[model samples]
Target chain A: MVPVEYYVGLSAILFTIGTLGVLTRRNAIIIFMSIELMLNSANLLFVAFARTFEALSGQIFVFFVMTVAAAEVAVGLALIVAVFRTKDTINIDEVSSLRG
Target chain B: MAPVNLNDLLTILPAVFIVVWACVLLLVDAFAGALGKRLTPWLTALGLVVALVLDVSAAGVQASAFNGMLEVDGFSHAINVLVLGAGLLSFFVSYDYLNRQGIAKGEYYILMLFSISGMMLMGAAADLIVVFLAVELLSIPLYILAAFAQPEPKSEEAGLKYFLLGAFAGGFLLYGVALVYGATASTRLSEIVAAVAAGLENPIFLLLGAALILIGLGFKVAAVPFHMWTPDVYEGAPSSVTAFMAVGAKVGGFAALLRVFIVAFPSLGVDLAPVLTGVVAATLIVGNVAAIAQRNIKRLLAYSSISHAGFILMAIVPYADDAVHRDTAAAALFYLLAFALTSFGAWAVVMTLERAEGKGLELSDYAGLFRKYPALALAMLVFMLSFAGVPPTLGFAGKFFLFRAVLEGGYVGLAVLGVLTSLVSAYYYLRVVVIMFMEEGKPQAAGSPLLNLTTGLTALGTVGLFFFSQPLLDWATNALLRLF
Candidate 1:
């Protein structure tokens, strides 16, 4: 019963929030979470659009996106752990050993 | 669902071979222990060779498979050869470097193979979902491989930075796909083309989607403004990994770019061409001018590769010009091949000369390299010349084809800018050559025969292919013929 425009608008707002979070966050974990937020927002839009059009492909795509996000989390957290072991911090600014 | 056929399975046989072999190798490495680590590189190389042969043999079978999710054709075949060849060269170069660095493991080869399969799929994918999957499949392994040297803090940092940016780019790409699907009610490239031809339901959504997709792919290819991750990632990661990423990622990104823009969005050309032209110009200016300031060799080459991305972009700028589309696409393919060989060769030399703790990375470390290793110096010189688009090398021929395509498309300004920027590139590229031969300092290099063989072969290809480029050009032309 909900209007499709409202769903799209909510998705846009969520995506923007996620983008800002990724841009401003200094902690690597938060950035990873923000990326998840962004992906989830896209999933939300995908579902809404799929329902509106009654197309299964868009819904199917969300499943793929979620699976990929989970896999990314696995790899991303491992990388963070690796960084923590060596650098003793997850703050991106403090992890600056390589620069031009 | 339609019943699957042998033809459908055969169409994606190369990628299937790689994925299955990579998984088997992963298990073998876990169980077999040290022997697995020793044999992994050779096994990985063998898998790539077999896949390459499969790709070549299936060259004549051009059809969409998996209900139009993927298309097997000349374009995919040509790009597969480049990706697989890059994988082969990376394997050869990594064998000794990994051992020397004390990080030799089975996962390295497995991850490389996994990523190569992803890249090959990118070349074949006909649906946006497949494209997104392929990109992630290629990139996730690279993120892990970037941090493969677990104890190295810089490598870890590189991995994290690459992952964060890569995830952000992936988000943009997914959003773009959603928008496009909403507008066209389909994700298949052929279907999208038909919809656009019939007139888009919402042109604004389609345009925004196309631009977002470009942003996502631009990040992958390291185009200017979207290329922040490249220098740090390339510099901090191991040289062998950086070499593979430089060629593999660029080729994969461009493969999708060519297909998505040319095949799916040709009707949107008038609106998209200017944006692409701007991207091409900025990539050239930023990628080259920035390289001049870098003192580190890896960082310098990273910037050079970014500029090379720009040169390759020139070939795609004319994607909408039907008169020149095939030629331009072929030119782009040829340029990718040339750049891959040259980059692999240069990085192999860098990997050989690099010392523990990353001590021999500064430009001054390369001073007097000629005295210690004349053959290495000569190989580096050839690579540098090739990068600068000098004569008697594939880079020259590749550039000639690209500029001709640009000129044919009536973008004389871009062609001219390409020429001028290449002239500027000559200064930095030649500086490496000048340092290797003219400057005096003792730089010891490892005598890894495999590494030496990689460097020698790529250098030989760089020069030999210049004269024999007609066959490659013909192959590239044939590849695009089916696409159009």
Candidate 2:
């Protein structure tokens, strides 16, 4: 019986924190983790909204988002490993072989 | 539950066929060893051709299928053909480049097919969830392919940067979708439109959601402010992959942009139009001006592609104007087709000339190219001219229609800026031509029949399309008519 506005506000805070982490993090792995946090924040919003409205569609969308997040992690971690192998570092600032 | 039917299955036949074939090819390549790598590109091309044929045959059957989650109509079919055509051309160019670069893995072709199928789905998606899934499906493969040449540090960096930015954009898109669903209580485009029409929700939520969605798509299409990843990604990724990303991603992004905005957010034109107009102007100014300082050919073309996105976005700026809706949509579609062909040709030439470890990308590397390979040089000339919107090319025809559409919609300032920026574009585009024919130095021309074929065909299409543009214009207009 919790109010929907409180859930929405919590999600907004979580989303803002995730965005900041992504923007300020220097490590590629941390940035990837930050992105996951952002997606999960959206998942929280979707679940709360779905519960409030009694709609199955929002929950279904959450499943898709989770699947997509997993797939992204698989690819993103592999890319991080590749970058590490080549550059011997995971810091994004040092991985700057391609600049304008 | 709605009854499942054969028609619904048939509606997604092209994408289904591609996905199945790609999976099969992945397994075959895994087990078959070297032979699979040799045959994968051809097999991938064959699958795309079949999908294209299937798409055309079913083009006239306009129907919403899968409980209205997907729409099989002229608009989707037209965009499918362009996306598939870009895939086919990229395959032709990739075969020899992969062999020369010694990265001819089967996974490359499989990933490409997956990406192409995802793009096709984006064109057909009628629900926001489907759109989100399609975008992820298309993008995930590209992130891997960007780093396909793993031992190379730059390629890995390109992949990492693209993945980070792309995932960030995906988060924005997801939040936007959730907000829209929260406001309207439905994710279906038609249902959402009805909700907006009925005025059941807070306008602020809808407006914020739409802006976020636009930001996400703008990143995919490489519009200004969101375009930082494009130059580095294009310049560092293998040229063939860059070609695919440049055309395929733009087509998918614009397809979703048009469908979502025109269908779901038409009621918010007063709020959205100024925002879109500002994005278009910034994209035009930044994309063109930045290219002038680029010495690397790949980076230069990257900026050019961004500028081209600006022009296409201009066509969509007037989508809410009832009088020019059809014309605007048609012009946008035609411009995508023209840009794809021209970009494929330009990148084909670039791929042919590109050396190991990404050397030979300098503008001076193209010096005296005409003397070594006149046909290749001439093809590059046609592509550059097309990029500059010179007359007697498909680019000119596409730009003419687009400018007229904006003018009809009473955006004279945008139309004028479009023309002026295109003039600025001419300097960089012609600089390549001037270097190719007029300058005197021996530029090494690697002989590859497949690359030559791709270049020759795209050049012919770029010029030939102008003379035979009537049918395409009619097709574009007819395609837009189906949506309404």
User: Which candidate's DockQ is highest?
Assistant: 2
Compute the interface RMSD for each candidate structure. 0.8, 0.7
lDDT of 2 at B325: 78
Off by over 4 Å in 1: B3-7
Each candidate: how many clashes? Answer: 0, 0
Could you tell me the TM-score of chain B in model 1? 0.98
lDDT digits (tens) for residues B1-484 of candidate 2: 6898887887789889999999999888888888886788788999999999998888787888899999888989998999999999989999999989989888899999999999999998899889889999999999999988888888889999999999999999998888888889888999999998888646777788788889988999999889999999998899999999999999999999999888888877888899999999999999999999999999999999999999999987877777887888899999999999999999999998988877789999999999988998999999999999998999999999999888988899999999999999999999999999999988886759999999999999999989988789988999988776
What TM-score does prediction 1 earn? 0.98
TM-score of chain A, model 2?
0.97
- Report the TM-score of chain B alone for all candidates: 0.98, 0.98
lDDT per residue (tens digit) for residues B1-484 in model 1:
7978887887799999999999999888888888876777888888999998888887777888899899988889888999999999999999999999988888999999999999999999899989999999999999999988878888888999999999999999988888898788889999998888888668888888888899998999999889999999999898899999999999999999999889998877888888899999999999999999999999999999999999998888878788888889899999999999999999999999999998899989999999889999999999999999999999999999999888987889999999999999999999999999999998989869999999999999999989989898888888888888
lDDT of 2 at B426: 99
- lDDT score, residue B227, model 1? 94
Native contact recovery (fnat) for each candidate is 0.77, 0.84
**With candidate 1 superimposed using the best TM-score fit, by how many Å does residue B210's alpha carbon deviate from the native?**
0.6
lDDT of 2 by residue, A18-99 (tens): 8999999999999989999889998998999899889888998899999999999999999999889888899999998777
